[model samples]
Target chain A: MDIQYPLELIGTFMFAISGALAVQDREHDLFGAGFTGFITAIGGGSLRDIILGSYPLVWVGDVWFLYAIFLGILTAFLFHRSLGKLRRTLFLFDTFGIGFFTILGVEKALSLGVQVEIAAIMGMFSAVMGGVIRDTLTNEVPILFRREVYASACLAGAIIYLVLNHFGLDRDPNMLISIGIVIIIRLVAVKYKLSLPRLE
Target chain B: MDIQYPLELIGTFMFAISGALAVQDREHDLFGAGFTGFITAIGGGSLRDIILGSYPLVWVGDVWFLYAIFLGILTAFLFHRSLGKLRRTLFLFDTFGIGFFTILGVEKALSLGVQVEIAAIMGMFSAVMGGVIRDTLTNEVPILFRREVYASACLAGAIIYLVLNHFGLDRDPNMLISIGIVIIIRLVAVKYKLSLPRLE
Candidate 1:
């Protein structure tokens, strides 16, 4: 199996958990958890596909994605884990997820012949908007505009990946390397309490 | 000017207001209200257009859509109204907004060559998902699944509109007449406490 596929599945699971986490406080049954989880897991991809003019949405066409989301939600529900798992050391996974999602989004967009700028925007969106939607659905402030360098971090990763790819790096390897850069940067920042300069 | 254009504007404004009203209990600033209002106003259209493979999102292209959302937020903020001004009739505007949005969504989907069944579904989605997003953002139960015939009413409206068109009504007249029917159905439903049988 290609490593990228596992990376994507892992990312999907992380996101599904994130979604399930939001609904945990509610009196929802497993169905509600799964429903919310499925939306969180695939919502960003769904929007990206729609914006890139891809029909049927990624998860819509691929039943496996749906299965993965439902499975992930149930797993999270029975386990009943907490965000505290990520609270202390979440930097690595969050940054990795963001960077990897950016690469996947850009690759798909370029394949669709979208303009480079638009492709870059899509990549940034792909990385962060899932969490934003999840957070928003949970009635919390979207971390995109607050806590982390969220969208900025994605844009940075996208720029580097695109530049490296243009310089003739193999796409998959460059993606992994670029994703690593994002993960490392984000982890270091979070470890040191780093943040973007606030407008106020 | 096409009278339909005014209808569209009213629909957009009412939709924005519904979004605004959803957030009134929270202490959001102009940006949050505007952003939420914009999403509520056009989320369904954005979804429909994307499902139809429209790129860049309709609001992304028009620019005016954003302006209106900003204006709506400003309007809501300036008035600092709590939806209290029209408490007795707020449901009327909200119901009208949903009906108009649903019919327009159905027409857009059919025009883009979606199958009739899918078009009807898309219409309901476009009409209701914005409210869902708004409610989700506010951490409230989505109005679509509760308290109203909501999406079901949309489905009925779209089917009726399609049937009318199939019977050889002119396009302009068809749109207006169908929109009117939706408005009536929705209003009557609200007035009489009509609702669909729940899945549970």
Candidate 2:
């Protein structure tokens, strides 16, 4: 089994949890929260696939992903209080999720024969678009436009992966290195309170 | 040329105008407003196509659509003051646009062999999702959840179209009749201030 498959499932679960938790303080009912979680987990990847005209959207084709999302939503509901206390841990998982998603998105786009530039954009889109959509659904200005070094980290990682792959680096090592770079950039940016300059 | 082709372009242009105008009160700049207009014009149809796994997204495959959107945005920028004064006219145009979009979406989905039920939902999605995305981008709750007789009208039209087509109505008449129903429903709802009951 490709290691990426399991990792993708884990990432989906983490994203779903975060999405559900995001609406906890709002007036959303269980169904609303669950819907939000579902979109947050699958929005980015499915959007990328859709734009690329890929058929049988990932979750639609694979019932397992739905199960994972369902389990994740259940976990969020059942352990909302406990999960609230685990903010730091959830932050780490979310960071890692974006990192993995970034590289995987880049790989998928490249394999589908998109231009390198478009692939890098698609990679960043895959990592951050879910959160963007989530924030939008929750009626907040998307954190993507306001947050520190989030999508930029994914773009950086995607470009690095492409560069390494062009230099004949092995796929597995390149994936690891690229994902690590994304995580590191995110961590450092948060640790230092770094942010992009605002448009004047 | 098919009459539907020119009507589609007109609909695209009208949607873009509404989108650009939506962000005018916000802090978004010209580029931001233009981007919003572009998405508003294409978001629904493109999303329907994406979910249906149709390739070479309409805007991506056709330069004419882009030109239409550009013209729409340009019109919005050039006639901001005059357009603001023509709210009633724009509302009618917007209503007609959605009406056309709903039927086209249903027709397209049926052509792609989606289940009738899914096609109905896709038809509504194709008409309303652009406004939903536009509202979301501007950090407002999607009007779909709060507005009166918008998407529901589209869904009703879609079902009507399907029923008529199933009963052996010709394609052109079915299209016109369904679109008319949508417009009439919308007009009555707005005229009467009809709205769905709020969740308790």
Candidate 3:
């Protein structure tokens, strides 16, 4: 398997889990659960592909991508009853997923020769925008609007990766460093119940 | 004052009305109503644009689109008490809007050099996918799953446009005939309460 493929798959699972976990308290059945999960995993990449004018979308190019989404959905269904205590765990993985997505998005866009700044925005968008959309659809207040550290954490991670890549840091070490920063920041925030002040 | 702009604006109004109506019974305030209304109107197009790799998602290209969306939302809010009757009126405009979207979508895709078949698919997608998604996000059983003639009408319109363009029709008549066919089919289906067959 190609390295990019595996990284994308891992990121996909985390995204699906994040999506599935959010609907745990709702009265969703298997289909709805799987549907939402599948959407969450692919939604950001799909959006990125579309905006970049990547025809047929990347998921259309790879079968495992779809299969992985389904796997996440099926797993979510089977585990729904037992996973009520995983908000913190989910958040950690979600942050990890966001970091991976940002790195992947920037790499893909840069490979395609988009400007680095636009690619950076795409990276951050690829990380967190799907959740904003999903929440809005579900009539919930999006975390982007209220959860300061979540997307901001992804942006910080994106900037790190971009700076490291520019300075010729080894790819593996750079990825590790960026991912570690995002996960630590997110986990610490969750662990300490840290949040930025809100207006209302 | 392009013709397509007016057509899209009308479609936006129809789209906003349906979204605004969905939340009439929910415990939403004025801001919530406007937000829901805006999402409903543009959400489908946003999805399509993202999928098609279209940038700024059209509405983001011009703030006037948002202004029109706001107007639609305000209109719906003021008339919320009369919505039961408004549904019938909305259906007429919605069906016309559907026709307009299908024709424009196909035409745009064709201009972009997409294959004719994909262009046809994109056309139907542009026309009907928005409403399908809007319903899904709002937790309503999507009209797509219910075997509504909505998509079928768009499909028919797409094929008609494809055939006419194949026969060398100019842009003006090609659009007119295609739009007319879609509108007629949609309005007729609603008037006669017709639907496609379902397995179960």
Candidate 4:
């Protein structure tokens, strides 16, 4: 009854598409696209593992993840033409990935004995870093730093997860609730075009 | 007899300046500039340590590096107008850093029992990643991926270090010779505008 398998696949695919989309119009060659795609798919988790001193890296030890990334790139390349039409689907996938990844990252950090505050930050970072790196590699200021509710949503979810854990919520139910909140918040923000105030 | 202290300082300053210069003309605020500068200064070494399972990170455990980065950012801010005039000096410092960091990274990986080839790649990565990350964060295709002689020179130095080690050369002498070779190659290449052939 591991719901994580499907969630991980969805997250991986979403991140890969985002990465590929960032470079679709940039005149990058196949290698460039693939490289970007791979980094975007694995960058966050790999960074989290490294920071936590976890060895062998996620991709290095798990060939299946590499296959997942390959599938993501192939989907992006084959559907590059119709990708625009799937914007809604893509948004849903992205929001789902963000929620799932934030929870996963936070839980991992906590298991590694990271302080609760640091673990929450790590969770937010894990959910956001892939896109930040993708944008950076494609020559764009990271969208996270913008007024958007993207990173904030992840942080909020992570804090909620911490609070739920403090209240002795079971792990699986806690994760489900935290992820649901993130997805709902993100969907609302996007639907309403909500944004934080920018510095003058 | 520790040459590493001075080399580390020189490398840190050079990377900070490079990062600052990357954003000098951009519309970034002071915090943005400082964050970019700090990332450029420490990004490479932190990554190398993480991959090699080294703990506490170079900057997190020691606060002096934070001071060095601050100094670097301050210098770049103060001398932004004349930074162009000091290109040669900056290049020299950068070259020194590359050589020193390559050796340091390779030695660390070797001590951790990584395979020789992988360790060499780690060396080049440690030397090149800061600039790569800097350019990426600033929204530019990495210059190292261009037909530049940059990464190749680091690889060459790493290979020479491996060869010297295989021949049972003393560690200090081997590091000195390898570093000298990288610095000389970089200087010569820059002086003559030497570059590898680009793919069609």
Candidate 5:
């Protein structure tokens, strides 16, 4: 069994948890929260597949992903009161998920024979777009456009992965290293309250 | 050339105009407005194709669409001051654009062999999702969810198209009839201030 498969499912679950929690204090009903959770879990990956013309979107083809989303939403609803105390844990999971998603997206795009540069963008898109769409749906300016270093971390990791691959690094080690860099960047950025400079 | 070709371009142009104008009073720069306009022009169609697993998206396969979007953005920027005075005319064009887009989306989905119900939903999606995305990007609740008769008008027309085609109506006449229904529904709804009942 591929080690990435279980981790991918866990990442999806964490994303859904974050999405569900995002709307917890809002006026949304259970169905609305579920819908948001589902979209947040699948949005980035489905978009990546759609743009690359990949058929049978990942969740559509794999029922397990749906189960994972359902479980995540359920977790969010059940733990809403206590979840506030788990903010740090959730943040760590979310950051780790983005890191994993970024590398996976880069790998998938490269395998599809797209230009390396486009692959890097696709990687960033896959990690960030779900949250972007979530914020959009909830009527907030997307975090991507905010002063956060969120997407930049993914892009940096993607570029690093491309550079390493170009230098004949093996796939497994490249994936691990790139994912590590992404997680580290995110952790450091958040710890230091770092952000990109605002446009004048 | 198919008669629908020019109409499609005009519809795209109108959608872009609406999107750009939606952001006119906002703090967005020209690039932001242009990006909004482009997405509003292509969002629906590209989303339809993506969900249906169709490749080489319309704009990607045809350059004229790009020209139409660019011209639309240019028209918006050049006429930003005067465009407000033309609100009624713009409304007519926007309504007409949704009408045309609804029928075309339904036809494409039918041709792709989607279920009739799914086709109807896709038709509505094609007509309204651009505005939804645009509203979301601009940090407003989507017009679709704001008690507008917008998407329902498209759904009604799409269902009518399917029923007519199922009863042996020819494609050309069916297209015209379905589009007319959508336009009429929209006009009447707006004139009468019709809206969906709010959830309790």
Candidate 6:
């Protein structure tokens, strides 16, 4: 078994928990919260796949992903109060999830022979769109259009991955480097409270 | 040419204008308004096609649809205040949009051999999802999940279409009846200020 499997699972779980947590303050019951979590974890990748004409959508083919999402929702429900105090821990998990999803999206699009620019957009979408959909469903402006530097981080990482691919770098190493870039950029941005300049 | 074609074009135009109007007070520029209108008109059908694995998404194959959306946006931007006074006129257009989309979605699903139950759901999605997404993007709760009874009308129409198909009714007449049912239900519901009972 490849190491990527476990990493991907961890990323999925964290993303799901993040989604569930976002729904906590809203007037949602357990089922609604769980559904929100499931969608937040899977929505981005599923949309990308559908646009690329990839069949059997990623979650549709794998039952285990559902298990991961269920576990994530359970964790969020049972320990949300305690988890709220651990902001740094939650931030780390989210950072890693974004990194992993960005690479996954870029690689998948590239494998399907999409243009590099489109592949980068797919990468950013994979990393950010789940949260966009979640925010939308919860009746809030998506953070993407606001102060978050999240999509920027994903796009930068994807560009790095594409450049490294152009240089004939190996897949695993390229992925690791790209992920590292995204995680570092996001962490630094969050720490410094950096945001994009608002359009007038 | 089938009469459905002209009706569909009119429905699409009305839906686009409705979407553009939704963004009127949201502080968006012309491009933003136009994009919102285009999405509102096409989002539901595009989502259904992607989920059903239908390629070339409806708008991708038809440039004429873009022209209709542009015209709708322009009309909304130019005469919004005047149009607002014609509430009944706007209501009729929206009703027609919903009815036409519901039937078109159901027929597409049936052609793809989707299960009748799923096909009904798809039809409802096609009629209501664009507005749902539009509201979400604008940071509002989707009307479908509220007391609007919009999806219910689409679902009722789709079920009627399916039953008529099962009885081997002619396609055009069946479509007309289903569309009529949806429009009447919606108009009556709105006029009476009726809504679904809230879930506790």
* Chain B TM-score, candidates in order: 0.88, 0.97, 0.89, 0.92, 0.96, 0.94
What digit string (tens of lDDT, one per residue) describes model 2 on residues B1-200?
37878988888989888888887776565655766787788889988997897877776566677778889998998898899999999999988889889988988898899899999999999999998888777777787987798999999999999999889999888888999999999999999999878779
Q: What lDDT would each prediction earn against the true structure?
A: 0.72, 0.86, 0.73, 0.81, 0.85, 0.83
lDDT of 3 by residue, B102-155 (tens): 888887777766667656667877876666565655576555434346777887
Best by lDDT: 2
**Model 1 chain A lDDT-worst window of ten:** A191-200
Q: Candidate 4: which docking quality band?
A: incorrect
Candidate scoring better on lDDT of 1 and 6: 6
Q: Provide interface RMSD per model, one decimal.
A: 6.3, 5.1, 8.0, 5.5, 5.4, 5.6
Sequence-dependent TM-score of model 6: 0.61
For model 3, residues A19-115, the per-residue Cα lDDT tens digits are 8667656544433444456667777777777668767677654557766776776667667556556765666667778888888887778878898
Report the poorest 10 consecutive residues by lDDT, candidate 3 chain A: A26-35
Q: Name the top DockQ candidate.
A: 2
Model 1: DockQ score: 0.12
| Alpha carbon lDDT at A179, candidate 1 | 82
Superior candidate under DockQ, 3 versus 4 = 4
Model 4, residue A159: what's the lDDT? 98
Error in Å for residue A31 of model 5: 18
Please give, for residues B1-200, the per-residue lDDT of candidate 6 as tens digits. Answer: 47877777778889899999888888898888888898899989988888778778877888888788888899999998998899788987788788889989988987876667657767987998898788877776766655355778888999999999999999889988999999888888877987653213
Q: Per-residue lDDT for B27-111 in model 5, tens only?
A: 5656557667877998899889888977767775566887899899888888877888999999889888888898889888888
Which residue pairs clash in candidate 6?
A: none
Q: Comparing candidate 1 with candidate 2, which one achieves the higher TM-score?
A: 2
Error of 1 at A1 (Å): 27
Q: Go through the candidates in order and give each one's DockQ.
A: 0.12, 0.17, 0.11, 0.15, 0.15, 0.15
How well does each candidate superpose onto the true structure, as a TM-score?
Answer: 0.60, 0.61, 0.59, 0.61, 0.61, 0.61
Model 5 chain A: weakest 10-residue lDDT segment is: A191-200
